[model samples]
Target: MKYVQLFFIFLVTAITLRAQTIPYLQRQGTATQLIVEGKPFLMRGGELGNSSASSLAYMEPIWPKLEAMHLNTVLAPVYWDLIEPEEGKFDFSLVDGLLKDARAHDMKLVLLWFGTWKNSMSCYAPLWVKRDLKRFPRAKSAEGVSQEILTPFDDRNRDADVRAFQQLMRHLKEQDGQDHTVVMVQVENEIGMLPSARDHCAAATKAYRQPVPAELMRYLTQHKKELIPELQQHWQANGGKTSGTWEEVFGKSLATDELFMAWHYARYVEAVTAAGKAEYPLPMYLNAALPREGKQPGEYPSAGPLPHLLDVWRAGTPSIDFLSPDFYNPRFQYWNDLYTRSGNPLFIPEIRFETGDEAKAFYAVGHYDALGFSPFSIESTDHPAEEPLGKSYDVLDQLAPQILAKQGSDQLDGVLLDKDALEQQITMGGYVFTVKHDFTLGWSPGAQEEQWPLAGGLILQTGPDDFIVAGTGLVVTFAPVKGNDLIGIGRIDEGEYIDGKWTPGRNLNGDQSHQGRHLRIPVGDFGIQHLTLYRYR
Candidate 1:
């Protein structure tokens, strides 16, 4: 009996240590990689529709579809109301079910905590918390009408959220810590204040009139040079005061209200995230509902982790690891550039699930070295094999090995082409390569349409004069950057990657490459081709 007890003790300790180990974002060369179980991991991920993960039945057919798309991770939600309906009492059936199913499907998970706020609404709060307006207050609009959003000013609100989140983390640690199946977790979804720039409730109104937190002021004063342009401009407009009320320090405007609310929001989230860390300490992040074009702070979901409010969020929630973009906007490149500013790693937790997203995914991973990209409403799509996204993911999976190796290095570059932009120029390895939209070949039916389809490629310079170029569409041409010598493609091996090793299928030449004039993947064909070039004197 004593031996049996000792054996059980040892087993429990082993599981605890395994669970404690977490995957982290680490830098290699100049590129950041998501390190899972002490090795680099690429997230070929997809997010479920809002209500899809709620039922085990709804997700039944979806699992195979995700696997068909070559996804490595599933971004599913964990609702606060469902998890803890009776306050202190918690229910983790849904979470456990997800873990079991995920393991069965051989996929990792990134659970999105739909707590307090989901897209800036208190839609996920429990009935008890939502019922008690006095204790669990809601944010208000300008005319004192209460909005469904919770006020960050209330301590009860923060404590309730923290308690619920802590319980969830504890449960995850107990259940999944040893398996390490869930690589990272999202603390909340598209967090923001809406209908107005700032919360107008009594508590929020009272706090707005007070001076900004000294910690925030100090952060602004300390990181003045590195502040995002919008935040910096707001501070500079009011003489960059050492300390004062929100308006007095940052001027009287909607931006000021946003700045004020952002601080409280960030602080509130920090408490919840810190509490969760105490239990499981999994990698946690927050996603921002981007500020829309032509929309003011109040017009869009203001605050959250929007680019301009990074300073406030950084000061408010130092516990939060990183910020990610929910990319619904058309300007993918511009938004990606903005999020990665200030050395923050780029990870797309959600984007529009349009077919064009496949191109954006290739460009993001290749150009920006993004940690991961997940399309929203992934299960909504039918027939993964017929979809362009599936084909894109399949190719991406093949090239991931080389892509991860070249991350943070100048040898890696990519370009996106659509109807508006048909071509781009890149210089790498002492040569200038011209990448164009495949439609330029004018051979395919879509090529002659009024608008060209999306096409892109990831270019990796593996050797001094050799490159592994993979993607659909576009013709690539090479030239010596500093000489009159003509460039020639000595050999082009069209092949597939299996287990990080290139297996050549066909020697592409003649018509496939415009008679060896350049390298072409052609329109309507998705492939990878290895090219070795030589410059003639």
Candidate 2:
């Protein structure tokens, strides 16, 4: 009788705890937040390289390094082969270990489901699944040559992938559901077709000749105003027809084939996402392998969640929260702007782990009011503390509290610069600021160098005349926004945020401010400066 009562009590406690919270995405005005444990969280996050999360022993040495790097969330892969190596049986040693280690480090996890497809190839699928090609057919090129990529047209392929995924989600619910440690799950990695815009498999080929789905046509018609321009132009040029084959509905082009592929890929992912959500109901998303410049559909990955295919994705996957970008492109602002259109919240899951990644982090969050920012291959660095990314993350940690508060509000903006573009302008608090790269000063050795490093900052309007300016290598000269009036920096206090409050260290007026000409924080110096502006006619 005593044992029965104790078991019942524990079970009820677990049920109640699970009911209290689940990881979700919440929109506060224009900003979106990853709500973990019923609280809004900014993911100061990083993703381990493709193979980093496979071993507990391998990850042990890097925990302290991540702690020093200031990452609060980790995006790691959950291998289909490792978790469910056999047919019906399962093993969760790796999953449980990842959860345990993340909790130990006081970090959150976003599990990437490498099921059936990873980077458009079935490379991550279990050996049993891979070996049985007839059971799970692969996608084919235009000449009927099969590629490693899986075709979405096969229901059998979908069923097997769905089962493995369902099992994974079910296991996650049992293990970490109460803890809310794993916040989000990416359905697959860079899913798309290669060397073919649309799969040449028999089912896919037949479907391509068939009329475009009525649902997709309806979406294009309804969301015409909001649809991306490239897609819209093709639809309009086709006389905005509602009924026709794939090429007839859109146009006869590589993009048309891509449209066909995007729809099928989205539908396939949607089924997986919807089924997984049924078990646990966590927020899910898909990441796009960006299309390179001048590359047609087959030249790139072709279909995976690119901007033009957004409507297709939206039409296909209501279960998906939003589409995310894996940016390796240099035109950071352009790509970010493309992803954030039509109320899609910006989150960069993976980016090139380069020198400018740190600056890009500041520009991304500060300028875009982004949900989160993370650079790829997080464990590859030799000395974590010595890295520029660590310094950038340090500054971001201090400003995070304020950044979250003002994210959806219009009081925040950021700037970015390179050798080609040395300066930019920002308007806030009724004043226009000439924000420029610190290399313009010509005082530092970098000023003499041909290349200008990425310099950027966040301008937060704390009051009508007062503001907080934080970032490296930037100078701001202010003037009245609506009239001809000279605006002078009344006071510029260099400081750091301690315990959510500003502590001033030095006052800049003479050379630091160009003798009251412009307020500046020089190159290679990352700090916060509080400034008060006064305007005179």
Candidate 3:
């Protein structure tokens, strides 16, 4: 009797713990407030390849590598063809294997659903869908050539995708739902029609010639500034009315035509997402392939969730939690700015997984207050520990708690220092600081002639008089803006991280500590440090 009672108690406790864990999802605002375990959670994720999770043999060696990078979430894909090889035959084996491995590794999963679109192409549709031209139709070019796009107008295509997604969601809810191993689901992989902006098929053209939907016109009128550049230009050129036909309201341009097709595509996908969410309401997000400047639709990968199309998408589709950016371009600041402009929460699902841009990760977390940031192909690196990207993530993992608490507020700030430009000014905790390059401060000019060191730092205000400064190759100074009594540097605390803990490496004293209320570290490398200051004459 006693053994049975103990076992029952243990089971209840595990069930309660699992119930408390909230799946982290996107929230609206400059500040990211993801609720996980019923509290605010921040994501530190790494994206795997499209089909990397299909083979257990290929995934075995990569689990430990992911853990070493301090990743809390892994972004893996569920291929449509693999899941439904034949018509009406759905397989859950690949998904089950992925869930099992993720649970074994003690990690959360973000499942990418590779359905109608993958990288602006319909390459991931099942063999039956691909082979059958009558049951599931394809889009056509302006020249009437057939393209490999699954038509949104096709009921069979919609039904198949919805059925497959619903099954996946229901199975996850039955198996891992209790444990909550799967945190979120991506509805489709960059859903867009390419090689042509708007499908020129009879069905698509008939629908395109119809009047603009009332909801989209209202959305454009209400949020005019938030419209995409191309859409905005078309609307303004045609007098910007909210009550006209599609061509009259949006103008008869290729941009408007693409928007029409994109609206239907987003609506179709939203229907599929709504069906899946009915079974299990975990957070669902969609990613966009950004458009290049001076590139027209189909010329550059045009349609997937760029800013102008967002209003149309949002008005037409309500099932999606957020639209995220996949970062392969160098304009990190510009893209992030656009995604967050409409109070949409920022969550970078994919970024270039290079070693040098580790500092940008800090800015994404500390500066933008992003819900989560993930780099693509996380398991591709051989030596993750020694690599700069790994090192940066290691530091972020250590500082996650503090970062979560004070991000988006003025209490925290970070810098990504480059060799070409070295000066930065930041205001935090009632002090304005001017940080200069090594050469600007009259440091040995030879330091510039030689390989310049890579350095970045994060500053956080712990209390009214207490602050922490952690990073490499930084010299900090403190001065009061208003009064003299509130302006003096007191001490410096430095430390290194070992086995998931901060061990004090060194403490600067005397001249190194105070020179007219300024604290400076002449030489430092990859580590963390804390500085304590007092207001005095």
Candidate 4:
């Protein structure tokens, strides 16, 4: 009897723990958080270059490099061709290898499913699917040329992807579901239409001529006021028709063609994502290849959840948690603003790996309340520990707890600064703060260079008069939000968080705070400091 009771207790505890550990998203205040093991998680993350995770032996040395960078999460690829080399038989060796290695390094993962499409091509599709063209047709250009991309309009193509993705998700559930090692899944890689805005295949043509789906038309009618400006203008220009073919409703143009393609692509992804969620639900998303400046539809990748198409994607793929951007362009703020609108939580899956990513990470998490930030080609650096990003990550890792606690409130914000945009004014905790790039001091040797290094940091107000500032190349000053009362720096302490506890170091009062004129973290320095402000007449 005693043995049976003990066994039953163990079984019950295991079941309860499993139920609690499945990763999910929850809204806290104005922000959304990725909750892992029942607590909010911030991904100090990086994405491996394409093909890095294909071979375990190739990834062996990369694990320590990631650890050195203090990345708690990794975004790696799971190739459809590799997993389903033969028609039916599946090999999970690569997926298993990634899970094993990621576990060994004590890191979580966001697996990118390179199925059906990658960067607008069917490059990662299984050879069997590619060769059996009759069984699996290709998307055609306007001139009737069969391109390498698979047509999403085809049931066969979508079903093939659906099966492969289903198997992968089911395997994850059986293997790592309880462990929750894989926190999220990116359904496809930079999915888009190219060479033409929309597919010109016979099936696509038929669909395009037919009246727009009532579901989409209904979505437009119901959310008319809430639609994005770009989309709103496009629809209104066509008299906001209640019923007609794609051209009749949205008009004849590249923009309309792109809109037509966006709907099909989104529905295709929705099918795959819905199937995977049915097997083992995980928070899934899609990433877009940002459009270049002044590029028209089809001149770029056309459409795959770009901001103007957000309404279409949301209308199509309710199962998808969000859509993200893979950055290789400037205007980080411009792109992020669009993605984060309409209650979508920002999570940067890829940015060009470069020097300024450290500062951007702070600005992203603090300013945008971003769930995470990642740089692509994370392992290319030779000196992993010495990398500036690694040092920034060290401070981020220490402040993760505090950052999470203060997120979703008015007390938290971030700033990104450079020569052109040197200063930003922030109002928090009944005080005004002037944050500027460290070079604004005009005394630094490199201040006069042609270009200034990117500088940024996050500020979190811990109390009415106290705050925590962390990042590189920033100087901050505080003043009264109202009246002419002078603000005085009561005290400042350079510190580090040891096991989530703040350990104060220097009494940065006289010179470090510049004789109470300002509180600064100079260029090339990455650390945290506590500051308290007082009012003086």
List all candidate RMSDs to the true structure: 2.6, 3.0, 3.4, 1.2
Error of 2 at 524 (Å): 1.5
Name model 1 segments beyond 4 Å from true.
1-20
Instruction: For each candidate in the order shown, give its overall lDDT on alpha carbons.
Output: 0.87, 0.87, 0.75, 0.94
Q: Record all residue pairs in model 1 with backbone atoms less than 3 Å apart, i.e. clashing.
A: 19-177, 30-408, 31-408, 196-298, 197-298, 438-474
The digit string of per-residue lDDT tens for model 4 on 400-429 reads 999999889999999999988999988999
Best by TM-score: 4
Worst 10-residue lDDT window for candidate 1 reads 15-24
Once superposed on the true structure, which residue ranges of model 2 sit more than 4 Å away at CA? Answer: 1-19
Order of all candidates by TM-score, from best down to worst? Answer: 4, 1, 2, 3
Q: Write model 1 residue lDDT over 1-537, tens digit each, in one string.
A: 999999999999976766555777788876778888777888888999999888988788999999888898999999999999897999899999999999999999999999989999999999999999888998888877899988888999989999999999999888887787888989878888878888888778889888888899888889988899988887888898988888889889888888888898998999999999899887889999887689888788988898777778888888887888898778888988888888778899999898677788888888889888899998887688777777878998898878888889999988899878888999999999999888787777887789776888789999999998988787898888997999999999999988878899989887788789888877667788999999897
Model 2 clashing residue pairs (backbone): none
Error of 3 at 99 (Å): 1.5
Q: What lDDT does candidate 4 reach at residue 392?
A: 91
Top-lDDT structure, candidate number: 4
Superposition error at 384 for model 1 (Å): 1.4
Q: Give residue 317's lDDT in candidate 2 (0 to 100).
A: 91
- Clash count per candidate: 6, 0, 2, 0
Question: In candidate 3, which residue pairs get closer than 3 Å at backbone N, Cα or C atoms, i.e. clash?
Answer: 22-37, 228-308
Badly placed stretches (over 4 Å) of model 4 are: 1-11
Query: What local lDDT score does residue 521 receive in model 1, on the 0 to 100 scale?
Result: 79
Clashes of 4: 0
